[model samples]
Target: MYYAILAYHEEAAVESWTKEEDAALMTELLEINDRLVHEKSLGPAARLGSTQRAVTLRGKGAGMITDGPFAETKEQLLGFYVVDFPTLEAAVEAARDLRRVNPTAVYEIRPISLYVPGTPLTARDED
Candidate 1:
């Protein structure tokens, strides 16, 4: 099954981390990621840009565009990981692995109902 692991953390706390501190944390996290990659369980993962750079659209159609996220919460959705695991337990374990390195963040796991594979685009396609 495919799972989406949503990473949430206090933006301020993360922003306060020094470059070296952040790099060290990522190094630890990547160690686990490397294991997942070897197992072929890892999929798409991403780190989101700061909320200050985000925008929200409310209502329908064009909607009402506004700066920042939709809600003002202590924790912001910082990043996400898409992974494939045989069972929920396995997926949770993977999230646990991630949490071990970054204990402060919250991991939200949900089974993906549908997945559409995109066609690989070449550099020439951008032009």
Candidate 2:
């Protein structure tokens, strides 16, 4: 099964990190990425630009265009990892490993619903 690991963190807290602290965090993240790659479970992953730069679109057609995210929250969506794991337990373990790098970070692990080219859209079990 495929899981989407969504990362969330406080922008203020992240911005307050020292250069060395940020570098060390990046190093740890890179190591995690390497481990995931070696396991062949890693898929698409990326760090998103700040939410302040985001544009939110709501309603039908060109109605209600707004600045920033859909909702205002203390923790912002920072990044995500799409991973393929055999079981929910395995995916949870992977998420736990990722959390070790930054205890302050929050991860939302959700199963990915695949779209069959000629079939109807479906949803996987939510985690």
Candidate 3:
């Protein structure tokens, strides 16, 4: 099964960290990523750009175009990882490991559903 790990953190708090602190955190994250890579469970992973560059589109018919994210939450989505694991327990364990490295961030794990072209959406299952 494939799980999507969503990372959320306070942008302001991250930006306020000292250069050395930031570097140390990055180093730890790199080490964790290396381990995931070696285990062959890591798929695609990336840190998103600042929310300032984000655009929100809502409604129908041309939609109302707006700048920035849709919500003004204290914590914003900062990054994500797609990991393949045999069981939900394994996926949750992976998320827990990531939480150890990035103590300040919250991780959300969700299973990915397979999408097939030209097939009814209702026909798809976790398989």
Find the candidate with the highest lDDT and give its number: 1
Put down candidate 2 lDDT per residue, 28-126, tens digits, no spaces: 998998999999989888998877789888898777868888656789999999988999788888889889999999999988875548997766565
Identify the candidate with maximal TM-score.
1
- All predictions: root-mean-square deviation over Cα? 7.3, 2.8, 3.2
Residue 93's lDDT in candidate 2: 88
Q: Over 4 Å off in model 3, which ranges?
A: 114-124
Estimated TM-score per prediction?
A: 0.87, 0.86, 0.84
Displacement of the residue 114 alpha carbon in candidate 1, Å: 4.1
CA-lDDT, candidates in order: 0.89, 0.88, 0.85
Instruction: For candidate 2, list the clashing residue pairs, or say none.
Output: none
Residue ranges of candidate 2 with Cα displaced over 4 Å: 114-127
Higher-ranked by TM-score: 1 or 2: 1
Q: What tens digits encode model 1's per-residue C-alpha lDDT throughout 80-124? A: 999999888999999999999999999999887544669553332
Provide backbone clash counts, one per model: 0, 0, 0
Candidate 3, residue 98: the lDDT equals: 85
lDDT per residue, candidate 3, 10-113, as tens digits? 98888888999989988988788788899998888898888889998998999998998866678999899888889888988988988897788998899886
Report the CA-based lDDT of candidate 2 relative to the real structure: 0.88
